[model samples]
Target: MIEFSEVSIAYQGTPVLREVSLHIGEGELALAVGRTGSGKSTLLGAVNGLVPHFTGGRLVGRVTVAGRDTRTHRPRELAATVGVVGQDPVAGFVTDSVEEELAYGMEQLGVTAAAMRKRVEETMDLLGIAELRDRPLRALSGGQQQRVAIGAVLAAGPRVLVLDEPTSALDPGAAEEVLAAVTRLVHDLGITVLIAEHRLERVLQYADRVLTVHDGRVSAAEPAQAMRSAPIAPPVVALGRLAGWDPLPLSVRDARRRAPELRAELPGAPVPAPIEPGAETLTCRDVVVRYGGTVAVREVSLSVAAGETVALMGRNGSGKSSLLWALQGSGPRHSGAVTIRGTDPAGRKPVPRRMLAALVPQSPADLLYLQTVGEELATDRAGEILDELAPGIDPDSHPRDLSEGQRLALALAVQLAAEPAVLLLDEPTRGLDYPGKHRLTALVRAFPGAVLIATHDVEFAAETCDRAVVLADGEVVADGPTADVVTSSPLFAPQVAKILGGGWLTVGQVAGALR
Candidate 1:
């Protein structure tokens, strides 16, 4: 249903994709895998003519979707044949309620009122979102919002559906909900699906084919074959490689079945030297946050010591973000006492509060606005910090022009330069690859102050954080050492822990003992 013939695309005189010839059959779920900023989005954009038509790039070859050449057809012209969903579902929303948002797409295509109503209901039912029809779009959970976004496009009855980073912001259970819906579309409806995701563990099992894009080249293979040498891989694949298993396993269950001999080789998951947390640097008491009638955060009390890192984790709507915002002192807090070294940051001025605690938000654009990376890091020895975190970034390049991973690094540099007593990061691994994540882990470990990370990435948390705190219904549910909290729960455990069934939470830990 989709074909690319010797397609070469360039933006600003730099080649993004070169000589890419591929075909995706109807009803096939094809996954595109690559490191950060490796032209994965460019390939997806070319499907419906977003690459050259809207991005103003040079296209040297032809891309045809459902036998319609993208050269002559713009996105609007091809809307009937193709539906595209972006990384942020909230950014693409045009209506306030779920039902209205679903119908808006059909209205633009001039679909009849009767057919629009029929398809809207059908799409919601198919996505298992029938109960959310009246919910406001902003109030929905991350997974629910993603489903509404998918249902909105599916109502148009397009032959091809494309998703970019569909579950980057969702927790484990929520990510499963979104992927389950996508797999149904391919199996029950025979819709051609093309998805680009950094979290391969969530989508690899559902994919029929995998397209590995690296350095402007695209190679097609089955999931098992593609993961053998893919540049970026999930923790399961890394464990398989470390053990020298023939034919890498894609899922935790498969890996566990093949891991008996390897298990015998290791003593119980090795225990590392305990880190001594310093005196308390951050403390919160009876924190309460509300959004009108809904209570987002309950009376939560927590404390973080100097030279310590804590992971704040929960479901998509379980008040993880709300708690982080309240502690930052800039967001809403109906009642709370947040102190850093005996100083109430909430009572200080904006500049003073920033000095007391620095927050690196989930979205990179929220932190970077200056024209160049050099100007943004022109204070507090941030250039030295960036050199240690991610070296060789062009100082003069536009902050917005950098790749997702590089932009995150630039933002981290800006925050680390402040030398605050407390540091908070929300979803820091959204666009980072394995190497980028390791770099971040190293930086977090070496910092002298306290750190709290609000994230959904279990593996990254295991690698970086010494403690884990879980929230449910806007209240703390689980709090303990990272290994104990993650390994004790199936939903929150990392791949290695799931496979080995012990204190192991990352491939690095297993590799260190086994190798």
Candidate 2:
């Protein structure tokens, strides 16, 4: 259903994809895997004519989808056959409510009203989003917005779907829902699907074929064959490699079946010493954050000590983001108080807010407005800070031109320039690869003050956080050591913990015990 013939693409003379050739069959789900800025997005864009046509790049050779040449057809012309959902769902929204968003695509295609309504309901039910039909798009959580975006495209009844990091913002359960829906489309409907995701573990099990994009080239193979040497892999694959397991396991269940021998080989190891948390650096007492009549955060109390890293994890719309905003003194706090370094942030005057805390919102791009990276770094006289946080980024490149990971690094550099006592990051690893996530982990470890991160990435939290705090329905559900909190919950457990079942939270911990 999709074919790329000697496709070489460039942007302003710089080649992004070079002589790539691949074919995706009808009813096949192909996964694109690669490190950050490794042409994954560029390759996906070529499928629907977004690369050279809408993105102002040069395309050589041919890309055909459903027997139509992308070179000869614009994105709008191919919309009936190819549906594309980008990484940022909110940016693609064109309607006020979920139902309207789903109908808007069919309306553009001039689909009959009766047909549109039928497809809308079917798409909503398919994705398990029927309950959110009337909710305004603006009030939905990041995960909800992502689901609506997918539903909008599915309602159009396209022959092929191209999704870019479709499950990045979703929690484990919600991600499973989205992936199940995609699997149903590929099997039950015979629709071709192409997905690019950084969290390989979540999607690899659902993919029939894997496409690895690296060094301006693309290669196709089955998941097992591709993962053997793929630069980006999930923790289960990494564990299999480290333990010398043959035919590396792709899912947690497979890994668990092979875990007994490895567990017996390695002796019980002591848990590493926890970080010595210093005196209270930030404290929240009965923080009640509400929006109109909706209680987003309900009388939640928490505290973070100096030199501590705490992860705030929960389901989508569990008030994790709301609590973070309230603690930053930027969002509504119907009741309760927040104090940073013994001074209430809402009442402080002499000391600047930046000095007290710095928050990197879920959408890092929203905090950036400058034309170039150099201009963004110059705002706070942050030459030294940029050099420290992100050393290799080109200062002259446009911020929009950078990759998702690079953009996130730039945002971190800009925020860290303040040298605040408390640092808050919301979904910091959304688009980062393993290496990028490691670098972020190192940066977080180097910070001297307290840190609070709100994320759904269990592996990232297991690697970097010292403690875990879970919220449900706007209330704290669990708060304890990171290993204990994550390993005890099936929904939040990392692959290593799920497989080994010995309170191990990450591969690093297991490797250390083996050594």
Per-residue lDDT for 283-362 in model 1, tens only?
99999999999999999999999999999999999998889888988888999798899998876887888888989888
Q: What is the TM-score of each predicted model, taking all chains together?
A: 0.97, 0.96
Q: Which residue pairs overlap in candidate 1's backbone?
A: none
* Global lDDT of each candidate: 0.90, 0.89
Per-residue CA lDDT of model 2 for 245-342, tens digit only, reads: 88989999899999999889776754766589888999999999888888899999999998999999999999999998888877788899899998
Report how far off residue 88 is in candidate 1 (Å). Answer: 0.8
Over all chains combined, what TM-score does candidate 2 have?
0.96
Model 2 Cα displacement at 155 (Å)?
Answer: 1.7
